[model samples]
Target: MDTRQRLRTSALVCAAAVGMLISGCSSGSSFSEASAPSGSSVASPPGAVSTEELKTYYAQRLSWRDCGVPGFQCATLRAPLDYAKPDGRSVDLAVARVKATGPGKRIGSLLVNPGGPGGSAVSYLQGYAGVGYPAPVRARYDMVAIDPRGVARSEPVECLDDKDMDSYTQTDQTPDDKPEVAKLSTAFKGFAAGCKSRSATVLPHVSTVDAARDMDILRGVLGDEKLSYVGASYGTFLGATYAELYPDRVGRLVLDGAMDPSLPARQVNRDQTAGFETAFKSFADDCVQRALCPLGTTSPEDAATRLKDFFAKTDAQPIPTGESRPLTESLATTGVIAAMYDAGAWPQLREALTQAMAGDGSGLLALSDSYYEREPDGTYTNLMYANAAVNCLDAPPAFTTPNEVDAAVADFEKASPVFGRGFAWASLNCAYWPAPATGSPHRIEAKGAAPILVVGTTRDPATPYKWAQSLADQLSSGTLLTYEGDGHTAYGRGSDCVDTAINTYLLEGTPPRANKRCT
Candidate 1:
């Protein structure tokens, strides 16, 4: 993803929040029953077990009990305390599932992850993916979700309190002077220190690779010889890592809104910045043709100029939104940027901008609130805090100092001429992290894995299409599936072609022909 896009994407809880969503998983060991088991249910480990043995492992251990998701059941599985040190202590991973609702045929369990790097996969299963997945596909495969360690219900990472998160989200992402810069740096340090102090032991184990390993253990517990998964956004990274680490264990896998791990933090950030520009241009093009465009501009550039001007004005003089605090530039920009993701949100953004420009700030404020997952009562979710903590630990900082970030920001602005600066500077957050990075960008090539489907949206703002291409190129068994549309994710967002292709692959263990494009 480009920098500006990454900033907006990541900023939406931190680009990491735009992960996938699945429904139907709870917290203990009783998943619903499947109609019939397929012969290839559990994948066979290299030269270790036969397919029949793997199937037996799954058939015998899958105890069905009612989970909170009415028809679903929850289960806990024990994994090694550390993959690197398999003989150490043990960590219990929370796994949930909804058995295929059919009496006809059953494939092994299909695992799904919504990509927060910290998003609760089990929650996704219980709430969305388990039930909402294409019905035909759901009828044939046991749907499952496992909340990775350091995520919700799986030894979650607690960085800051609600008040701390509120302050962190409202802190100026754009600094005007040395003191402001120091304040920004202090906020980063404080947030990082909070994670280190509150969730220290688990910090070292939250990397994408570690999460991938955890998934493998879940695969073993479920008696699936191979892992079948649908990962969105950051989950794509996780899925891809699994493919790389245990290629031979990969069953029908799909990665949506794929991220290219081979790219350095800065390049990924910049590319995402450009992506937002593309999405913005699409929004602006639609807005300008309308008679009521808030900007009253003829072109996207003019609309962007108007936005920058408004942001500057807000920075100089905050506008009261009928709340205790007034709207600032950062908040205003965040609100505007949030709308650029899905074109369906454009009209709402236009109305919000019009109201903001006309001296009323509630509209824009509301947008910001939604983007930050904040309620009208000034309460906040832990999404942002969790986002930052996970991101800071997953990758090292792109730059080491404010000056370096400033230079990068200038370059970003030159590239986007709109969102570059804001996003570029946002990248600096990791630079000020109190704890050193526990992970760095790495390439994942699931060499011996089955065909893995990698999905990309051509105009996706959060994770640009190029990322999918990059990831497909990097993975040994990667197959690129393109959605020629606009949106963050494609599966259930309304593309028959995208959905059909993925559903077919998920249900029948088929991969879309390599480099397939759909609209």
Candidate 2:
């Protein structure tokens, strides 16, 4: 898994903004939680803020209002932009929630995050999890989401404008020479500059650790005894960090499509590249069984080879789509990456590939558009900007220079021939970030936390299953739940065994047997 795959892995909350891949809130001006996170920081974590210091913040009341949606409430709360200076500036966090629906004993609040560190938890809660989650769980607990600082509805990080981003995303990531490398470098520099200039106040404060602290704030404000969470994809990282910081406050954590906090940015990206290859192979195998198979062969290697040939062809002479923009190799690869997220989207990928192979690039273009959250009008959201902001701040760049990336290509190629070079170069986006990272590469053992459930899918493209295993192994009381199937995450994707186990945990607080494997 190289870095490009990691970027594609950030979901827009639990709801699919473009309906492509998977992955919010409440406020009261005031509520009474009997106790807040203690000063006790297990493992002697230096980052944890003592309960005494945060009392004023925890006691602050939120002024909730009826948002556009019925049964959904929205509000804003202020979190210190930087935890180091608690008396310093603050950033507004957007929150939303749907109250429990059933007449059962309420089980407190159930907070959900849909993977991307930048994903909008408010939109997710309002659109999907708030209503789509299991009835029993919904009945028992209020579904909550918070647009973590520097995310949508929060103080979002803004980079390039739409037209500029259109040009930026199409920049050739697999640069072959010095001139091309400089072009890619310029794009990255411009993107980092854009964020720093437009969102300087917020960009430096959006690290996962900052977000984890915000989650504790949410737990305190929600008046919950502990934090019960369902975090997917990159959200798993946030949840784990929270556990690491507030081990005593952990309650029924389900880290679906879990990420290993121990792995640095480069290793994570490389692993994700391999995961994409695994998923691509699965898609290819499935494609061969269909009549519209674009690769037109049963061999997965041959399929990859043929697809590479298509990318080369597009690189030289981009195919014409219905729109003015031609389908370049970069765009085509983005389209393919988008589909590799979910097995359900394989048919769409095949059709897109088939259409592209026939010189009509509309289908592929749409997929690429969806992945980037690009609208037809050429406007764009801040997903990519916040993604880079949080990611770069959470960990240092995988490569600091094009030469370093060149040196890493061989290992990445060994990981995934299809995505290695592109992803490796893609990692350079953070090298030029203006803010020095606040966090470092370290393991979150959560040494005193109660049972934390880490879920994994066998062939998940974005977050590989091994990450879940690693996370479960590292945590003080983490339980590994294996979903032996495909797609990004395991729960709520039609696996009866996986759903039942998670539902049981989320509902009853009784975790499945350790290392439980569900097919």
Candidate 3:
């Protein structure tokens, strides 16, 4: 609910990348999508604007150039506060793009989203997605990132001050009693209320659908005839929505760690709970086999039981890390959970866990700090706040009451005996959100769109592998590209088979087939 939790998934993407990014591909080149998004449908939100209204909202906007840096041009575009009233109030969206350094071939502009539904597309463009994308693709097209409305540097939605966020992040995730459950609920409510009071105007406009529409405007502003994009994690959902809403405008799209729009909110939460469990199992299996594993068990199941017991102990008595704050079960779990996103962090995770279980909590504490983007100096990024705001608004809260949470806990526990209970409650942050749901889960057919690549990892933590399969099946033009490996996302997570296949598609306009699988 507070900004910290809101950006949890997005921040985890970065924290786990402290080392991965060091070795990631960074040279860039570019090339660029087809028809409308034609999958399944959810009922349109009330006051849905017509295409003309949407177009008018985009066209009337003025852009002012600002110096983002040496190589990129930055501007802000105004879109209607509410799309249905095109002539009404407006909100500014920050946009950035580095023009292609073409001495090669001019393909087109390519928009890139680095997940986060809450992640800053502009930051992603400048930092990771833009500069680090493969060279051939970068050389051919201008690389761009748009910070979604209600996200960082775009009239952001604020939910907590630094102090309040600190408390919110340390709130007990595993409820041991009625009072603890109430505390958790209160934390969720307080976090939600902060957003309502601070960012009331635009909370309603931050849905995935709204972001998708905004992407279209960016396409028009960039002078691109169609939308060409690469979206990772939740960005996959935004990209799919764009394809569905403006199928005719979809040019070339690659959705990595795709979300299955057909799953209900609770189902989505449960499935993700299971995914973390699966990832943990993989971690445990590998951990026990390694010399450094501190939990010390021969089998993954035993290692998992050891972790659950450790969490239970932390809940009963949290361990101090010598900081002003101690390591609570919630923070500890979050730290471990964060590592599940990328296998590259497995070594660090092992070290962190060993230190924590041995009474030296600095390593696990540091991992949690990284995941929360809590800098060593104690300041925090707005990523978590935006992550929660967008997630809560795009869909209904996952649970209505503690009983509902309790009912789901058994299944969640079964899914990943170590992570299920905590994630089940983490999903509840939206239950107390102030914004009403403007979107519902629905399958995107993308029937008339060109072939779209849907990449998935077998052991992805945030967006599970099955969701990718389901999404591919749901989309009329969907092609499933499988990486039988570990990590939250594919594409550039270090695989020649995976990287070359996707690069070929982005560069040559040839999507791997629906059943394509790479080791």
Candidate 4:
């Protein structure tokens, strides 16, 4: 729930994508009974696994069964817990697929990942991608998804329990003074410690590189010579990593809402702050024209001031919701940040802001709950925990201490006057992470890879358009497809141009022209 983590976690496509696919239903499934055994760890040195070592994994065939959801088949695939030692402890990855409903000759399996480093790919496949992707695309390609290690249903990393998590989510992220800062630091330490205590076995191995390797294993298991994928948000990073490691294995890939792998963690967080600021201004401009503008009717600047003032007021005196927990400044900020991911949520945000301004914090609090994936019964999905795990492992922390955060506050605030301070402090959490970072900022030039499509939305709040541009430039064969619009991702958000370009690329293996723009 920390805003700093929102830098990459913002690519979480579940909330909006699932909402569009299914009404009034949870997008996640509890695959606990099918989860792999935990508590096994081994030191596997980093390097290529010899083909001999990987033969067992590659030769294994999936035993698919009815997934209990009509038209879907579920199965589990075994991968090395540590790839360096393929014969060592193994992990089971949950995979789901809806075979191609073909009128045209079947092309191949199309793997889709909807951006949460922690997002449940299985659930996404069931709730959205498998059912909601464009018909022509789905008809020729067997839609597929795999829950990566330490994500939902795949030996998930457990941090704080439900009650502790609720308290953690409510923890004040933007400290006003020394004691508050110390308290915030303690909360972060506690969350990290909880993860270490609960998920020691899988902590070190859930890095993005590891997940990308798992994707390759999946590709082989699916009998596909190359990977045909559509990765959004953090999934873009995942796909790019796969291409970087195995350039020849790259097939049709559409990396929507692309993330730049070359930027350091702090820069990523700061850039995202600016991205959210851009999105908020868009919202503000739209809001002030409405009859019930809670922020202000004067100008976007006035609206921002009012929103900041409202945040300050809530910080001073938390607003009470109908429930036992009141809406704190942290929760309110999360609520607003959640809405920024998709413009579709703007009206909901307007209503929530209006209700909060009228002293009812329930609406905003509900938005916060949705962002955290907290269920009505107060239990939570493993999304946030896995988000922290994967992200913390993928790159070094944004800040090593409170002093660094304090020093960077001015820069962050300059980037985003409203959400900057909170986001800067939120970046401090990963500094207390239990495992050392296994990866670092590095460019991914997938030299000799097949042409990969990179899609960017003009006002994408989470993964900014600039990141997409940077990613496209970095990948040797990457083609940029620009959507001059708002939202976290471009394709399937009702843009015929974007969809047509991607579908054509998927079917015909021809990427759109470089820098193709669509409104």
Clash pairs, candidate 4, are none
Using lDDT as the yardstick, the better of models 3 and 4 is 4
User: TM-scores, in order shown?
Assistant: 0.86, 0.94, 0.90, 0.92
TM-score of model number 1: 0.86
**Sort order, lDDT high to low:** 4, 2, 3, 1
User: Which candidate, 1 or 4, would have the higher TM-score against the true structure?
Assistant: 4
Q: Scored by Cα lDDT, where does model 1 land?
A: 0.71
User: Model 3 misses residue 416 by how many Å?
Assistant: 1.2
* Candidate 3: regions farther than 4 A off: 1-45, 54-57, 60-68
Better of 2 and 4 by TM-score: 2
| Candidate 2 lDDT tens digits, 478-511 | 9999999888888778888999999999988899
How much lDDT does candidate 4 score?
Answer: 0.82
What's the lDDT for residue 321 in model 1?
A: 85
Badly placed stretches (over 4 Å) of model 2 are 1-33, 42-49
- lDDT per residue, candidate 4, 183-298, as tens digits? 99999899999999999999998998889888877777676768899998888999998888778788999999898999988898888888889999999999999888888799
- Order the numbered candidates by TM-score, best leading: 2, 4, 3, 1
lDDT score of residue 511 within candidate 3: 88
User: Model 1, range 1-519, lDDT digits (tens) per residue?
Assistant: 122222232223224431110000212222222311232432222222332323322333434567756887877666554555544555666778887887658887888887766667777787778788898878888898888877777777787777776667667777889998888778777877887788777766666666776676567656566788988888888887777666667788898888888877778778878887788878877888899999765888898788778888988888888876678777787787777656667777898788888888877777777666566566754455455656666777766788898767777887677677777777776676555666667777766677889999999877889989988988887889999988677888788999999988887778889889998
When superposed on Cα atoms, how far off is each prediction in RMSD? 6.2, 4.1, 5.5, 6.7
